[model samples]
Target chain A: MTNMNPSDKALVPFVSVDNMMKLVHHIGVEPMLRGLADYIEADFRRWELFDKTPRVASHSAEGVIELMPTSDGEVYGFKYVNGHPKNMKEGLQTVTAFGLLADVSNGYPVLLSEMTVLTALRTAATSAMVAKYLAPKGATTMAMIGNGAQSEFQSLAMKAICGVDSVRLYDVDPEATAKAALNLAGWGMNVVSCKTAEESMEGAQIITSCTADKQYATILTDNMIGAGVHINAIGGDCPGKTELHKDILARSDVFVEYPPQTRIEGEIQQMPQDFPVTEMWEVINGTAKGRTSNQQITLFDSVGFAIEDFSALRFVRDHIQNTEFFMDLDLLADPDEPRDLFGMLQRATQ
Target chain B: MTNMNPSDKALVPFVSVDNMMKLVHHIGVEPMLRGLADYIEADFRRWELFDKTPRVASHSAEGVIELMPTSDGEVYGFKYVNGHPKNMKEGLQTVTAFGLLADVSNGYPVLLSEMTVLTALRTAATSAMVAKYLAPKGATTMAMIGNGAQSEFQSLAMKAICGVDSVRLYDVDPEATAKAALNLAGWGMNVVSCKTAEESMEGAQIITSCTADKQYATILTDNMIGAGVHINAIGGDCPGKTELHKDILARSDVFVEYPPQTRIEGEIQQMPQDFPVTEMWEVINGTAKGRTSNQQITLFDSVGFAIEDFSALRFVRDHIQNTEFFMDLDLLADPDEPRDLFGMLQRATQ
Candidate 1:
């Protein structure tokens, strides 16, 4: 019943996981991460252009699922993501996500893509982006606490963006540390598996906490940190779930993605509501200082934000348009006369 | 990489729009509406069991898009919907939607279905459900103020659930009213096309206002509304949008799906913060009152809630299971070993 030609520009482009991986492989993960970081930084600089809201979350007995939606005046994007810590026991990833980007003018979805793998990449890219501005210059060593599915990306992105040359990894599970180290092999970085969280912090210029528990377990205490170290706190993203001790936050100049949201979901959730925190966008726009001195301690509270997904989706959509690795789904209905939606249904029956 | 057998009980069945329509045709719309009404009522009775949040909306210059998410302990559901009143000029539906139902235990989507048509159906069913409780017992005639794409569904659903025998229709566009009447020709209901809203409401026991305007246009005023008339105010949703006059809300005992949401989106938005309104579930569960007297005006302030879509998804999933019209989508990655997500990328290269 659609009158539009098959080559009409109104049709939406969809990218599945298989095609997304091809795009990553073609462009290389490091470059994709760098490009995504640039888009994110640009969007963050024009933060007033977005319509933002703290994500609406549904908490169950096992885990939580959330809908993170944001829009510029032109494009709207939302990510459906779930965090189930015990899912690994049931042979499932702790996090799975999918997202959509729609045209605000007509309110039609222009793109839909799997965001499971993309989230890992963007989270790492965001962490690395913060480190570029907040970390000590030429930081060569990083201590990775709770090395799991995310550890490899964090290590690689940090190395690519911040010139981190060595990673000391520690996890409650030795197998996870081995997996992280194995993934980093031949990447021209020294990987050391430490027995304790304290041991991992030794000689490290930056410390990244990526633990995956649903509770407030301090993976990094105040005593475990040293001066001039940038703490990329990635895993402590929900209320009652934190990896850094409160004293650690007290001693560091904390930077966050969105203060209203990060204060409720980031490690700062453990701190008072009036606790001091600077938004990372301020640092990116040069409105606020990032690393004032080489010996100063800084914390990047890495609770993911909607702008990051918006940037990643745009990047994927652009790359997919230039390539042929994506699939097109009949996601939107195209009627010869859109008012005759009923007629389209009747034709489908025939 | 999937190792699970086809007969695995852990499998989550999905029914797309094509399959869902086949199931609806097989069962017939009348019975399906009745079934969905039952499910919606059951959920509404136990509304306290749900985790409710006011929908997250992003409003642009042209239109508004919203994410409505809700969950019980077992199943989580959310719908992505948009309302662009001017979209019909651009050959697009005024409202388009899609939704997902996921298993809370594993955070995997069990069903993904198009909600454009289903939303129209469920919205009508929900209106009928509320009318059954709020309307006068022998209500036989409904004054449909706006004859748009949704008018036919509302007429049929009201006939099926509330024994509505006739509909008096009025629309700014007479062609839309003619279309509604033509679609309902065989539905065994008397259709009277009227020139004005005042003439349409004469002797009508139920008045349904489903007009599509993004401003505060008063489609119905207090002088036009009759005593004991159950007003199904459907279109006054989002900020700056209202169908009924503020005086009508002040006169009627308004009932809403969720108070926090209806406060911002429903007709109650015009009222004060402490303005008294009844939650529909409380009335359904017999904790609150509905139509205490025959002459008392009752208003169902329907901005549409997520739970109705959750029920609709559940209904479609259950009905489409025994049908063969669905396509299997490899949306979720099923790894032979869950920890081997990296292996999926490696295998894709080959």
Candidate 2:
């Protein structure tokens, strides 16, 4: 008879892509987005307790692979993500991700999950949650420039968290806008397909630019962003990539996730080295001001910090308990006698 | 019927720990170690092509979690590992690991496997391979200074690759020595258990010190190490952990894997910053001299590097083809249209 504890230690809960989608449907997307936003906000409130560091990145001419790790004393989490803009031309997703959550007490992995869907969810939840504090009061409209894989999630997250009801979608590729609009049908938002980026911004209190390209293309110019609108610029996330013009950054009150990382990978990378920016955690903690006046322009320059992923993993860990959305994977070697690893290998044949 | 192409893209091969043991038994351990050593040697020969960076680590008072990533312009791989010395008391392995190999062209993971067992195998293979090049000519006996989980693998690897026929084992705990000796029985090698570290080194041409503890430790002093002996000191793999006295290092020709990491984490952490050392890749590439004379003392200060893990993953990826040792895991979200991730999630319930 096989002992149970070694097998228990061997089995890590693995949330496959199918299971993750099932979990999403089980919880409902809107409620899951709201749950993610709540966890992110709570983590942000106690940000000082976290062990934060800039993501370790390995860059190539074609793309980049990054490892983002963080710990909060009790648990540790990390995401393995790759960003390749050229992948879409070959009928592949431009970004794919997987992540793990481990118990910090004994250093054994407890959960492993596909984060491609979860990252899109948490990123949108983060944008909407930030907009709740920084956007124009009672904001119900958003201009989503670049209607691609992330557009639907960003629109729905705003609808769920910040009560935004309408989305004005625009993309250079007209089929992208149609695709996003088609997928978001019957979900919960009024989605408008616009030909021009300028036309998409009509009557919108928030503008989110998430174009996936490797170049330093300015999708939004200084004149494009008007006063009192919060801009969520995420596509310009690596070195030598920025979406907004520098003059636009000069006019906006920029807030970032983590200063050390944001200064290198966010929209603030285009600005001067000493550019003033507020850390969003302090704003959420009430130590720093967010939106002071209706006429002030605000920009949330998110480069996807590690703490946000840590929070999302925590949310998934809490949700997968007593649920059938994950499989038990024997991903760690747990010998009956910890010192007899070879004996375990020998006994496997018996 | 649902489409299969998108589902194909979603699958990644995962080798669980149990399956890893089966794989080990299917393809015997000695052959696998030799294969891993061959891959590692080839990688070291072409080291310039790889993108090598120090591991990203998160350290707490309890332990450390590290992510080591490397790419050779074609394929990318990374390992997620944790080291917590206090874990054995809680019935958990002190070190547990998992790894992933990914395609760089489109940025998707190709394989995910348990590396705790693989790491032990590869670490032993590396030490044996190094001994093949640096140990005294026709060396047949080794003194394994720590009889823990790694002792049997190290002893056997030397027997397989370096022609060592006997291992004299020593550990502070007598039970550990007995355990290792029991495991190595009937394996065509003579194993001896010793009470003290000094007694184990009698007539041995190679000394492998792999004690497990977190401190400024000196398991071997200068007087204990004889001339022309190759010392494999690996147990002290982090800051404040050293297994050899500084005087012993001063008298030896030190070879290291990635000097930047070794200076901080290897036995050389106790040495001066500008202490002379040679990168092992240079030796493998024939650019540097190794063990030039019979009377010269050689010390291989090993603090495992990312390239070795990259090589180990490469070996596993090649071995799993046409083999029933791995399962296809749905770890990536692949939509039919690539952009309709929301639709993919929506259809999972049906």
Candidate 3:
């Protein structure tokens, strides 16, 4: 009666942070980012089939913990993420995440993977995918104004997915900018370190701001922006946190992942309740126009939605098959007789 | 520059199902159940300090998957559980679950454990703890209806926590009754396998009905209950599933875990909007009465709540401290410099 070994149904494929890094290098970072962008794009093309809700969040004085859940009928997925702005001072990542994918039929988790790296990858891929629809034609350079943890991922994603050949990096902390520049040195793209946000935007057709302040900070002022460039404003993600001035929102045609969520956590949170925005999925499916004119400023106010994480986990679940990148985790209990859970426990005394 | 090993901060302790059984056997099951009951009672005493919300559930044609989350300011916890009633026919556990406990201050997961077995333990402990307050004095015999997965745990908990010495088991399926009686054979108690529900209730002071049908079920009717008896009805957890008849609820003094949740998922869900019920926490904290007289029928409408799971995970987190019942999984990404996540990933190329 003593069953010491777990059966196949009891084990879930788990991709740890170490194995995730190995998988990333095994597939090459740029190509992997491109592949993730494709997956995000595919999900967006059929976004109407997904079960979408604003992520459930628990806020504290120090930080916020959130659960983002979504499903595409056949498979269900959810991500556990936390953001503590002060964690950087204590030598910890300001954001950490993990996610799971489960079968809808049996409600058993099939894959569990660390998403700290995957979140960074998926976030950048999402921005680049939206840029492919909204950026100015032949855009070759981008102004990266954060230079924090997500800076390099955003840079490489744009270069790989959007054909951006050059990147100008800037941050309030010079060391952060130096670190990002050093990391992107051999990524086959021309990297430039700039002293000021205005200097970073020079000769760039795309301006991506992703700073790390919990409060509302004006990283991009209205007067500093010019026409005919795409603005990817991702830094203003939480309430009381906005990167672009309200006047800039008034001047650009904004595109968002999900309006209900973006209204609360994106730059549009500063706008009126009736503020107009286009959903990116509509643009991907050709139901709505994207970048109608090169002279019109296209702003992608990305707060990161559940569907993106679902797509990322879906990609991991599919990619880890027949590979040594994942280990079997005994996460579920499987008894010979479903109703005899106690009998199994009793036999475990052996 | 390549770092081959994860840092101490990156690893999180994970308890698999096998480890959970080992932990349970390391400390005897009865002692662990009593320990969990104490932890749950202590949490109930401070019920006002918790941040509570109804579970977030995603329903499907086959079953339902839910995330139950709660935080008590310093520590946060959530459980992912699925209830697929049809899974029994497919030789799968009807309910499977896993849970995590995290530090609210830093938002880092501290412990991850398989909860299929722990949930059974906690649910039974909760029932018996409530019985300690509401059952008639010197209650020694219990009628155990629905001898399924939770039957053995319930019987032991009633014995360990409430001094119940005899258990009369009855199920529609005779095989289920035989299996439960077989499992409880070694325990120091009088176990009687009854052919009918009426025979199981002979001289019993406590009647626990935990049938697993997804629709409205009537395992206990109004006439089946007698004066001065404690009714623990636990299987009516989902929106449309209930175990006890509504007439029984109207006749008894009903008590519940959390009223808002119980009204939708407990036996009281069959009653009207204004039906009055007492909260069990009030009874535990001395704000309300439990069993006032020998002739009054007391019913514990158990739908299960997030706080119970939090307490259970808390107990696991405390008990597995120095034991080898857990393994550290590299679940989080710990960069030496928080802002250099890309730099850390680049160094992993070694």
- Among these predictions, the greatest TM-score belongs to 3
> Stretches of candidate 1 above 4 Å error?
A1-12, A333-340, B1-16, B272-275, B292-294, B333-340
- TM-score order of candidates, top first: 3, 2, 1
* Candidate achieving the largest DockQ: 3
Residue-level lDDT of model 2, residues A2-73, one tens digit each, is 442347888899998888888898999999999999999999999999988888887888889888999899
lDDT of 3 by residue, B247-298 (tens): 8888899999999999998888889878999999999999998899999999
True lDDT of residue A263, candidate 3: 95
- TM-score for chain A in each prediction: 0.96, 0.98, 0.99
Runs of candidate 2 exceeding 4 Å displacement = A1-6, B1-6
- lDDT (Cα, tens digit) per residue for candidate 1, span B1-350: 43223223223454544555566677777888888999999999889998787777888888889888888779999999988999988778788888889998878888877787788789999999999999998999999989887787788899999999999999998887777677677779999999999989988999999988899988987788778889999998888899888999999999999888889888889999999999999999999999999999999999999999999988887777657856554455544445445555445555
Q: 2 or 3: which has the higher TM-score?
A: 3
Q: Give me the displacement of residue A220 in model 2, in angstroms.
A: 1.3
User: What range of 10 consecutive residues in model 2 chain A has the weakest lDDT sum?
Assistant: A1-10
TM-score of chain A of 3: 0.99
Which digits, one per residue and each the tens of the lDDT, describe model 2 over residues B1-350? 45433477889999988778878888898898888899999999999999988888888888888889999989999998999888877777889999999988878999999999999999999999999999999999999998888999999899989999999999999989988998899889989999989999999999999988888888998899889899988898999888899999999999999988999899888888999999999998999999999999899999898889889999899998999999999899998777778878777766
The residue pairs in collision within model 1 are none
- Each candidate's fnat, listed in order, reads 0.32, 0.72, 0.81
TM for every model, in the order presented, reads: 0.93, 0.98, 0.99
lDDT of each: 0.83, 0.90, 0.94
